[model samples]
Target: MSFFKAIRIDQRAETCDARYVDMAEEELMPGDVDLAVTHSAINYKDGLAVTGKGAVVRRFPMIPGVDLAGRVTRSTHPDFSAGDLVVATGCGVGEAHYGGFAERARLSGDWLVKLPGTLTPARAMTVGTAGLTAMFCLLALERHGLAPTDGPAVVSGASGGVGSFAVALLAAAGWRVAAITGHPAEADYLTSLGAAEILAREAFAQPGKPLQSQRFAAGVDTVGGVTLANILAQTQFDGAVAATGNVGGMDLPASVAPFILRGVALLGVESVRPRIALRRAAWARIATDLDAALIDAMCEVIPFDQALERARAIVTGKIRGRVVIEMP
Candidate 1:
C-alpha cells in the first residue's frame, strides 16, 4: 500500500536521533490486529524514549509512544474486528516494539482493552498511561487497607499528569488530598483538582530524620529518591505508600526505621508490565471513579505532529495534567 509518516529514532556514530519519516505498513511489527490510530498521549517514559535521556529504547530506529486508542482496521484475533474501538497501554508498546505515534499500528489483541461505553477514543487517551498509573497507585493503596475515612493522602509531584490524576481520583474517592509540588503557582490548580492542602517541594524534598512526625495516612508518590524516603519517614503507622516514578532520582536513601517500627508499607507500582487482570481492573475503576469534567479541564489536546514538543514539556515538568495527541 502507500507509505505513512511515523516518528522514528535512529542511532548514528554512537549518537541517537529522532525524526519523522514516511514508512510502509510492512515496517510495522507482527501482530493480530491493525489499527487506525485516533489518538495517543505522551507519558514520562515516552519523553525519555524520544529524547534518549534514559535507557528507554533497546533498539535503533524505533517508534515511541506508550499508549494508544483507536479503531481496528484489520484483525486475525476472533475477539476483535474491523471498526472495533480499542485501547492499549504498557505491554512494552514503545520500548520493545514499534508503537503508536503513527496513522496506523499493529498490536497483539491480548494487549488491547476494548474502550468502555463511558469513554470515547479521545477521552480514552485523555486517561492514557498516566491516568492508568494513577489508578494502579490508588488500587495499590486500597489493597493495603487504606480507606478514604482513614485520613489525608499525599500526592507527590502533584502538577504532573499522574500526580494530577492521583489528586483528583483520591479526592473523588472521598479522601482528603495533600498536594506536594515544586511549582507554588500550581497551588490553585491543585486545589481545583480537589487537593485540600498544598505542600511546597522545599518542605518535603530535604533530607530529614530517619523517622519524622506522622503525616499522611497514605500516599501516592511519583517522585522517587529522597522524596520517597521522606514520604516513607513521615507516613503514619500501618500506612501505605505507592511509589511510582523515579523523576527525582533512582537511588532511595532510606532507613528501615519506618518499616521496622511503624509498619509502613512501601508498594511499588509498575504499570508497564502489569498483569492483564490488574490492568483490566484498573481501567474499570478509572471508568467508574474518574471525574470526566475534571479530566477535560486537566487535559490539553495537541495535533500529532506536536507530540515531540509535548514530550519535552512532560519531561521538563512544564505540562500540567495530560497531553493527548489527535491522530486523525
Candidate 2:
C-alpha cells in the first residue's frame, strides 16, 4: 500500500476539473504527520473549489476536500503517534494546502486533532467542517445569552449540512427550533429533527424593513445578504444571529435600527483558522452534543470517485445534509 488514490484538481487555460488519480505519499505537500484518510467530507466551499465556480482555489493542482477523518500512520509531533484516530478541518486545508481528497494526506501536525474514542472516523467526517461551523454558531449565540426559554431558534438554509446539524443539536439541547428552507417539501424531515415550525424560504428571503415583528430569539444563518438582513430585522431584543455564509448574496443591505432599537447582535462565525483552543473545544462538544442517530441519518457515504459530481451538487443546493467521501 505504498500509493493511494485521490481526487486531484488541476487548472489549464483558465479552466479546472477534479478527477480521481493515483498519487504517491512522497508527492504530498510538506508536513510532519502522514495519515491514511478513511473519510473526507464535501463542503460548499469545496464545491466551489472543485467545480471552479468560485475563486476558492488560489493555487492549481490541489486536492479539494476541506475536512477529513483518518488514522495517523506516522507522526513526529509529540501529541500524536502511530495508529491514533484523528480528524482535520479548516486551516486552509484542501485549499492553500493539499488536503483530504486523497486517501493519503501529509498534513501539518499543528492541524491534527485526536478524535476521542467515542467518535469513529466515519462519524467524524459526518460532522466535518459543516458540523463544526454549526457548533460555533450555537456557541456564539449561547454566549450572547440565547436560551430555549427566550424563544425558538431559527435555522435558515435548514436542509443544508450546517443547518440540518443545527436543527438536530438545538433540539437535542432542548431548544425549540424553527427551520426555514426554500424546499417546503423538507418540512417533515426538518420536523423529525425537532423543528417546531417550518418557514418557507420565499417569505424568509424578502428584503429587510429595518425592523420587523420579533421572531427568532436567536438564529444560525447559512444564507446571507437579504436573508440575514431580514433575520436581524426580526430577531428579538438582545437576541443574537450568527452569520456564517453568503450563499444568497454578499451585500448585507441592512441598517442600525435592529442594532439600536432592538439591541440585537449579529455575530460573525468563522471556523477556518480558528484559535486552537476554540477548535478543540468545538470538536470535543461535537463528539458529545450531536445525536448519533441524527448524524447517521443526515450523513451519506460516497466513493472517492464521486467527489467531483458531489462537489458540484453541493454548491448548486442539490445536496441535503452532509456528504462523506469514503477513501479507496
Candidate 3:
C-alpha cells in the first residue's frame, strides 16, 4: 500500500498534538521487515505519549503505540519471510521511532519476535508490554532462587495490567498472592485472577519501619516510591523484589536495612531493550504457563477510533485490565 492510516503525534513549541492521518510509506523509518499491523495495545506509557502527559515521546511526528502484532508482508531479514506472524514490544518504538499506532509498520528484525504457537495475535497483544514485564519480574524472582514454599508473594498495584498478570502468574506457579490495591472495590476481581488476599494500598503507601515484619517471600512492585519501600521492608530474609514502574513517584524514601541486614535483593526489571533470547524465553513461558481464559477475562477490545479515549483512561488509573485496539 502507498498510504495508510495512523495516529501521529506532532511536537510543537509548547506542547504536542496527537491526531489521525493518512501517512505515506516513505514516512516510515527504515527497517527490514514490513508488517500489515493488525493489533496494538494501550499500556500506561502509550497513554502518556498520546496525551502528552509524560516525557515518553522522544521524537516528534511519532506513532504512539508501544506494542504491535501482525503478519509480515515483506522481509529482508534471514529469520523471517513474507507472511510470518510477528510481534514487537519495547526497543524505543513509540518513543524515538514510528510505532504500532498505524495500519502498517516497518520495524527492525531484531525488535520482532515470532508469536508463540499457543498465542493468537489478539491474545498476544492482550498480554502486550504489561504482561511481558510481569513475566520478567517472575523470571527475576525465579533466578533469585525463590519458590512457592517460601511465603506468600505480594503484588503492589495488583489491579492494573502488570499487577494483574503478576498475581496470576505467581499464583499459577503455586504461590499464594496478596494483591495490594487502592481500589478496594476491585477485591473480588483481583481474587478472580488468583489473588488469595487483597490488601488496601494505604497499608503500604506510607513509610514504615526500616525492617517490618516479614510477611512476604517475594514481590512484584509496579508502583514505586513508598509502596516499594514498604514492600522491601516487609519481605522475608533473602527474599527479592522486582521493581518496574514509577507511577507512584521516583523517590525511594527507603532504608538500607532490607538490603544489608536481611540480604534482600532489589532486582530492577527493564523490558525496553532486553536481548531477543530473553524475550523469546519469556513468551515461551507465557505460552505454557498463562491461562487463556484468564487472558480473555482481562482484555477489552476496542476499535481503532477509541484508542485515544482509552489512552487517557489508562494513565488516570481508570482502566482495570488490558485494552486491545483492533485495526480497521
Candidate 4:
C-alpha cells in the first residue's frame, strides 16, 4: 500500500485531537529501519499523548503510540535487516518521535530490538512498555537484595498494566505477592495472575503515617504521590520499593523516617532510554519470566482506530490490564 492508515494528532492553537488518516510512506520521519508495523499498545503515557490528557505529545500532527512490534521490510543499520521481527518501546517513542501508531514505521536502528523468538508481534505489544517497566522494577528490587524468602511483596495499582505484570512476574519468581487495586471486585482476576492476597485501594489511597507498622518486605509501586508515601512508611527494615508511575500524583508526600529509621531504600525505575545492555537483559527475562497464559488473560485487544476512545478510558481509570492495538 502506497498509503497506510494511522492515527494522527493535529494541534489547533493549544488544543490537540487525533484521527485515523491515510499517510504516505514519504511522510514518515527519516530513520534507518522501515517496518510494516503489525501491532502497538496503549500505555498511560499513550493515553495522555493521544487524548491530550497531558502535554505528552510535544509536537503537532504526530503519531502517538509508545510501543510497537512488527517485522523489518527495509533497513540500513547493521543490527536489523529485512524480514526480521522486532519490537520498539520508549526512547521518546510516541513523544519526541513519530512513534508506532501507523501501519508503517521508520525508526532508528538503535531503538529496535529483534523480537524474542518466543513472542509474536501481538504478544510483544501486549507486554509493551508496561511489561518492560515491570521488569525494570523487579531488577531494581533484586539489585537491592530483595528475595522471595525475604517477605511478601506488595504491588500497588495491581490491576493496571504495569502492576499486573509486576504481580505476575514477582509471583513467578516465587515471591509472595499482595495486590492492591481500586477494583477490588476483580479479586479473582488478580488472584488468577498469581497474587497471593488482594488488598483494598483505600488502604493506600488516604493520608498515612510517616512511619507505620511494617508489613511488606518490598514493593513495586505504580501509583505515586500518597500511595507511594504510604508504601514507604509501611516497608520493613532494609526493604526496597521500586517506584515507576505517578497516576496518583507527582507530589511525593513522604518523610525521611522510612530512610533514616528503617533503612528502606526507594529505587527509581527509568524504563524509557534505559541502557541497551539492560534493555536486552530485561526483554530476555520477560521472554521467560512472564507467563504466556497470564498475558492472554491480562490483555484487552482494541482496533487501531479506537485509540482515542481507549486513551480516554485509560486516563479515567476505566480500563484494566494492557491495551494492545492491532495496526491496520
Candidate 5:
C-alpha cells in the first residue's frame, strides 16, 4: 500500500493530541531498511508520549511506539534482508523518530535485532522493551557477581510491565524474589509470577534512613525517589540495584551511606541506547531464559485502535503486565 495506518501525535497549542491517521510511505523517516510492522507494544514512556503527560515526545506530529516486531520488506543494510523477521526497541523510536505505530516502518538496520528462532513477532512484542530491560537488570546483577545464592532479591513497582517481568525473570533464574507493590490486591498476581514475598509499598513510601536493615541481596527498582532510596538503604553489603524507570519521581531523596558503608552499587539501565551486541545477547537470553507460556500470560493483546486507551491505563498504573498492540 502507498499509505499505511498509524497513530500520530501532534501538539495543538500547549496540549498534545494523538489520532489515528493515514500516512504515506514517503512520510516515514529516513532509513535503509523498510519493515511491515506486524506487532508493537506499550511502555511507560509510550504512555507519557501518547497522553502528553511527560516530555517523552521530543518531536511533534510523530508516530509513538517504542517497540516493534516485524518482517523486512526491503533493505540495503547487510545485516538484514527481505522477508527476514526482526524486532526493534528504543534507539529513539516513538520519540524523535516516526516509530512503529504505523503498519510500515523505515528504520536504521543498526536499530534492529533479528528475532531469535524461538520468538515469534507477536511473542517478541509481548516481551518488548520492558522485558528486554528487565533482562538487562538481571544481567547487570550477574556481571556484579550477584547470584540467586547471594540473598533474597526485591523488585519495586512489581505490578507494572518492567517490574512484573523482573519478578518472573529473577525467579526463573533462581533468586528469591520479594515483590513490592502499591496495590495490595495484586499480591496474588505477583505471587503467581514467582514472588517469594509480597511487601507493601507503604513500607518504602516515606523517607528512610541512610542505611537500613539489610533485607535484600539485590534489587530491580522501577520506581525512583523514596522507593529507590529505601531499596538502596536496605540492600545487603556488596549487593547491587539496577534502576530503570522513575515513575515515582525523578528526585532521589537518598544518602551515600549505602554506597560508602555497605558497598552497594546502583546500576542505571538505559534501554534506549544499549550497544547492538548487548541488545542481541539480551534478546537471545530472553528467548531461552523465559518460558513462552509465562510470556504469553504476562501480556494482554489489543487491536491497534485501542492503543491510546491502553496508554492512559499504563501511565495511571492501571495495567497489570504488558500491553501488546496488533497491527491491522
Candidate 6:
C-alpha cells in the first residue's frame, strides 16, 4: 500500500486535534476518480472543521478542506481521464468525506468539474468555494431582474472571501458596490476590488427599525442575523437580497414590512448542493467575469501544514483575503 501525507483531525482523549498523518490509498473513501491534489483553499467552514469550533465535522479522524484543484491520476468514469485538470467544491468533499488537505484525493466523478480554460489550478483554488458562492449570488441577483443600472448593491461582510468576490464581481458587472465590513483596515482592499463605497460594520450591526431608510437597490449579504435583517429592511422597493453565509448568527430577526410592503426578495444562496447545470454555469461565469489579477491580490498561499493555524485565524476573523494551501 502506498502511503501519503494528509492532514487529519483526530479525537484524542476527548479532545479533537488536527495534524498531518500518513495515510494509504486504500483508506480513502470509495470513489471513481483519484487525484494528485495540488491546491486547496481555506474558508470559514474549513476553519470550523479544522479547529473543532463548530458542529461541522460529522465524523472524527476526518480530513477537512472544502475546495480542491488538481490533476486526475486515475479515473473509472467515462467523462474523465488521467491527466485531466479538475476542481471540486462542496458536495461533502471536505465534510462527510476525506477532503483536499492531503497530497492525494479520491472522490466521486459527480463532484468534480473540469477546470475552465480561463482558470489555472492555482487560480481556481484561489477562488475556491467562496468565489463559487459569490458567483452563485451574482447569478441569483441577475435572475431576480437586477441590472447594472438598477442601483448600488450592498455587500455585507465585505472583507471576507465571498463578500470580497461579490464586491469585485458586482463592480465588474457595472454596478456600484458598497462594501460593509467591520475591518476598517480593509477599506483600501475593498476599494481596489471595485467597491465604490466602504461602509462600517456599525452601519448595519445594530438592531434597527423594520423597513428603515431604503438605501440600497439590492444586496449580497454574507453575514446573517442583524446584518442580514438590516439589509432586508434597507433594500429599495422591488429589490432583492441574496443571503449566503451565517457567520454572524443563524437567527434572522426581520419583519414582514420588507417582504410585503417593500416587496423585497431574500434569496438564499447555497453552493454545496447546487444542481450540476447551475454549478457549471456559475463556474463558466466565474472563469469569464472574475479578474485573475484581483484574485491573486486577494489570495495568500501557505504550506499545507499551516492549514490548522490558518483555520483558527479565519474562524476568529484575524486573516484577510483567501488562504490557499499548497499541497506537496
lDDT of 6: 0.89
Q: What lDDT does candidate 3 reach at residue 219? A: 99
Please list the residue runs of candidate 1 whose C-alpha ends up more than 4 Å from where it truly belongs after superposition: 312-318
139-193 per-residue lDDT for model 6 (tens digits): 9999999887878899999988899899999998899999999989988889999
Q: How well is each residue in 1-328 modelled by candidate 4, as lDDT tens digits?
A: 4898888899987778788888999999889999999999888888788778788887777998989998899999999889999999998888878888889999998888887799888889899988899999999999998898989999999988889899999998999999999986878988998999999999899888999999999999999999999999999999999999998999999999999999999999988894877888888899988778877877788887787788778888787677888876
Worst 10 residues of 5 by lDDT: 313-322
lDDT of 2 by residue, 1-328 (tens): 4778888899988799788888887788898899998999888889899888988887879987889889899999888999999899998899889888888999888888999778888889998888888888988888887799998899999888789888887887789998999888898999988899999998877785889999889999999989999999989989889999888998998999999998999999998884777878888888888778877888899988787888888877788777888987
Segments in model 2 whose C-alpha atoms lie over 4 Å from true places: 315-317
With candidate 2 superimposed using the best TM-score fit, by how many Å does residue 152's alpha carbon deviate from the native? 1.8
Model 3 quality (TM-score): 0.96
Return the clash pairs for model 4, or none.
Answer: none
TM-score for each candidate, following the candidate numbering: 0.94, 0.94, 0.96, 0.94, 0.95, 0.95
**CA lDDT scores, all candidates in order:** 0.88, 0.87, 0.93, 0.89, 0.92, 0.89
* Candidate 1: tens digits of C-alpha lDDT, residues 1-328: 8677778888778666887788899999889999988998888788888877889988877888889999999999988999899999989898888887888899999899888788888888888888889999999999888998887899999988889989988998999999999999998999998999999998878899999999989999999999999999999989999999998999999999999999999999988874878888887888888878876886789998898778867778676677889984
Sliding window of 10 residues with minimal summed lDDT for model 4:
312-321
Q: Pick the candidate with the highest lDDT.
A: 3
Candidate 3, 1-328: lDDT as tens digits: 6999999999888788888999999899999999999999998899899888899988788999999999999999999999889999999988988998999999999999999889989999999998899999999999999999999999999988889999999999999999999999999999998999999999998889999999999999999999999999999999999999898999999989999999999999999994899999999998889989989988999999999888878888788688999999
* Model 1 score (lDDT): 0.88
- Ranked by lDDT from best down, the candidates are 3, 5, 6, 4, 1, 2
**Candidate 6 or 5, higher lDDT:** 5
Locate the minimum summed-lDDT window of 10 residues in model 1: 312-321
